[model samples]
Target: MLDRRRVLQTLAGLFLSSFGLGGYAYAWEPAHQGVTRYRLKPARWPEGRRLRLAVITDLHVGGPHMPVARVRQIVEQTNALKPDLTLLVGDFVASRTRRSSDPAPAEWAAELARLQAPAGRFAVLGNHDWWQDERAQKELRGPTQSTVALEAVGIPVLENRAVRLQTGAGPLWIAGLGDQEAFVLRRRPRGLPYGLDDLPATLAMIRDDAPVILMAHEPDIFARVPSRVALTLSGHTHGGQVRLFGWSPIVPSRYGNRYAYGHVRENGRDLVVSAGLGTSKLPIRLGAPPEIVLIELG
Candidate 1:
């Protein structure tokens, strides 16, 4: 039966190819880091003011692929870009329990402190940052350990807060919302809020009509973002952590691949979702390699 033998050979070939690909995704792609750059001129952005932003998110430190040494490399690479502002979108701690080491927050924060940005370095906590803080979760309030560690190293964690900064471009507002899925693990009583994010309050903090840049850990909030905000930066999906040909089968977001990665523009609003560095549940990466996103906005 020649036809039968051919079918068996084809199946064997498919198995071998898949096995090799799996090996590469697990061992090589997870450690290989790259920079993904985007240039945007949002409608509300100042005409003459060009801002270079270095966005680092989902560091997931202490994972096998993201040791302290790798963080140093990231800092050095970002510093080389010499961005006007450095924004940390969060997830400073490791997400997975197995095969992952836990580095003290101070250790990673110290390295992050070395990141150079002329305008200044600002941060916002992610879901993992909240999840990692057992005490904060138990209490249903924060000052998460990641927040303390980052602030200790001079990085201000903006939670439902906005700061007005005078940049070469002009006066701009950087608003950061708390992690939307912060209490995913814990059950709450009825009428008790689950997420710490407060978008309206954060926006209210902005006094003027200056263009606002919102740092939200998850891109799901992009739907509610109004035209007043120039740009919204987020990084939690990690581009589905295994994108294939621009499609992700298991995107963590409710919107699927719509906000999975890159600059997304909708309804005259803009969002940039970084693929992010470090792995989550599983330490494997395929088409979605680890990346540090650089945004040049005007």
Candidate 2:
């Protein structure tokens, strides 16, 4: 048998070794790039009403970073959640600086179309789509091509339009706005042809009492959204792309990190902004992991 001093020293060394190995394993392992789920508890949610919404955005497909495998993984994970509504918040392709000869990035839309929900799947345009190649991107809506890829599979694209949902409780309106950042950056006369200014008018068109859920690409407009709208789902900030010390290093938006990522409350409107599955500008992430936000509406 070993002496007490010898045994104590041996145990100390083993403890240190194990701790070091564990730390290194955690640090070296690829950042957990998977979808994360969240439950949103609203103050006035109607009892027995459950609306599970999965929001995906900023998937800059066709790059060394995101690749096809990662995109598929995101889709699989999303479907696993079994959300009632699957909202594709845009940035499907990164075409701004890519060339025509480059492998078409729109193919991912077909992959995304596989995502199914009881109610339906819907999508809207993001700023990157317009900046990259509006014409080629628009091809996604074409029949022969992948334009209607999402819709072809079953996910309908909602561009500055609204859809009426038949919920267990009653009826709710789901509307999607076109790319707001594109118009904002372009200094266009009108941000969106039908925007916050015409929200009341649009609501008048949709006959529903369960409240309206707006799908805008970015959360910057959350402040301007009417409180009566209830909730807004968006992506595009990529949760600041890279996070540091639990905060995004740089959130590329006019609102900065305030509305950078995750769930944020602004002007009494609940907004869930996904960090996104793919990377943009860079292929690495620190504190910010790729995510699938499970928004629960009661």
Candidate 3:
């Protein structure tokens, strides 16, 4: 009889622990925001020159987890960092259909417009941005609503393009690749690329030999990223949205946790994948908290 009582107690304890963990994951971690910082001196970085970049990505705004007020708070927090460059790495709109509000594009863009950076603020669209655009999906072409909204607020959406920024270090080139999963092509056209991304053409636009920072929404592209790019930034997997002890069980990337989150260096190339600012699918997070990534480079 005593042994039976001990087994019941053990089962009760396990049940309570799981309930508590679930509550924290659902109610607490998803709402709270934090900052993650990385300082790296890439091999190609100009000597004695430093650059601070604030990266905000996977906002998935308009959802219960990320309202306009949260976006405003994010902008305020990013501005406080006083970064040299601010990068909006994409997924501004919410993908979840349930328990989500549809905040107009302008509403969120207005809040993001308040973000300030010394060099400039730049942007790239994510898969969700294109997926949400009905017209773009049907036409298999873009000028997605996400792009129009950002551009309307004076933030340039860099789609497979590169621009030179005059930073304290020197001329730094920022190249943004279009969303690789931009459109759901109905039928593959002969000789036509699957998605909107054009990495080769984008790289061709670079006229000078300045160190380059590439922004691709999905980190899978990092596998093909050449050594020429000093660093690459991405936000998509959301660090599996429930990471624990530096391992995520369900990473969305094709490469699994290899490019899941944080700084990853491979064969002389570097990539930093932000855990991102808002939840996706089901608004729940565990060990991986929402974050604004700050990268210091030299």
Candidate 4:
């Protein structure tokens, strides 16, 4: 016969193990559908010209769990919004360490290529992409291959660079910087090409007359951005991964709570950080569901 304490301990271990498994499964399922709308009020945007922009990020594509079908569905839904411009804010593929080693990013890229917009469709690299060295090679979700794949289907990937888009009235200056996290790694800095030269100086290169919209994968870089930028778009937080009843489980940031999740304003500039469409390491999201944000530039 087993002792009382041993029996209790065995039961407790089973209960805890089951709870962990259940929680993981619950968070892994892709929940929430339909579009989220936001009317942005920018002080510098020209009057009477409203730009429809759709932002999607954290699609850690290339897993049996992620499946290209999901990406196709996301693209179809996004195109239905009829955005003037679509921005892919990075993390296109899951890091090698994260995936189960079956599906690859090429499959996902083909699905992502299906996305389209009238004015343009653009993208930026995520930390995961850098870790996978997709920038150096032309295959499997590398920055070069990922960019090439998108451009093939008409979406351009901006890496620490800027592009000028012409609206009905005039042109708007758009810029994108690579993942800032890659820059901090001293040992393998060259291993990842996710460094920004000088954010302040880069914005200076764009025309001052046009409204500047910038994309940096990590929102933490917002502090370094120059004042001329009208708005900054970012991801990587996944909106705190797991949001409790009234709090986020763990907000992984250097500043801690300064820019944890969602839309925030700093130094009179606007920032829209998506809750994201896909999961990272654990493949789960709680109170915070996957999101697709539609920003009406006003």
Each model's lDDT:
0.88, 0.66, 0.86, 0.70
Looking at model 4, the pairs that clash are 134-142, 134-143, 135-143
lDDT of 4 by residue, 33-124 (tens): 45678898776777887888899998877633466778888989998888888899988876454445635556677777777776677888
- Assess every candidate by TM-score: 0.92, 0.77, 0.91, 0.82
TM-score, cand. 1: 0.92
What digit string (tens of lDDT, one per residue) describes model 2 on residues 169-249?
467788887666553333334333322223444555566456788888878878777766778888888776556676764
* Candidate 2 local lDDT, residue 36: 65
Residue 26 shift from truth in candidate 2, angstroms: 15
- Output the lDDT of residue 31, model 2: 32
Select the stronger candidate by TM-score from 1 and 3.
Answer: 1
Runs in model 4 with CA error above 4 Å? 1-34, 98-102, 134-145, 183-186, 189-194
Q: Model 2 off-target regions past 4 Å?
A: 1-32, 100-106, 134-148, 183-204
What 10-residue stretch in candidate 3 is worst by lDDT? 1-10
Query: What digit string (tens of lDDT, one per residue) describes model 1 on residues 99-118?
Result: 32477889999999999988
A best-first ranking of the candidates according to their lDDT comes to 1, 3, 4, 2
lDDT of 3 by residue, 51-86 (tens): 999999999987768889999999999999999999
Candidate 1 residue runs with Cα over 4 Å from true position:
1-17, 97-101
Better of 1 and 3 by lDDT: 1
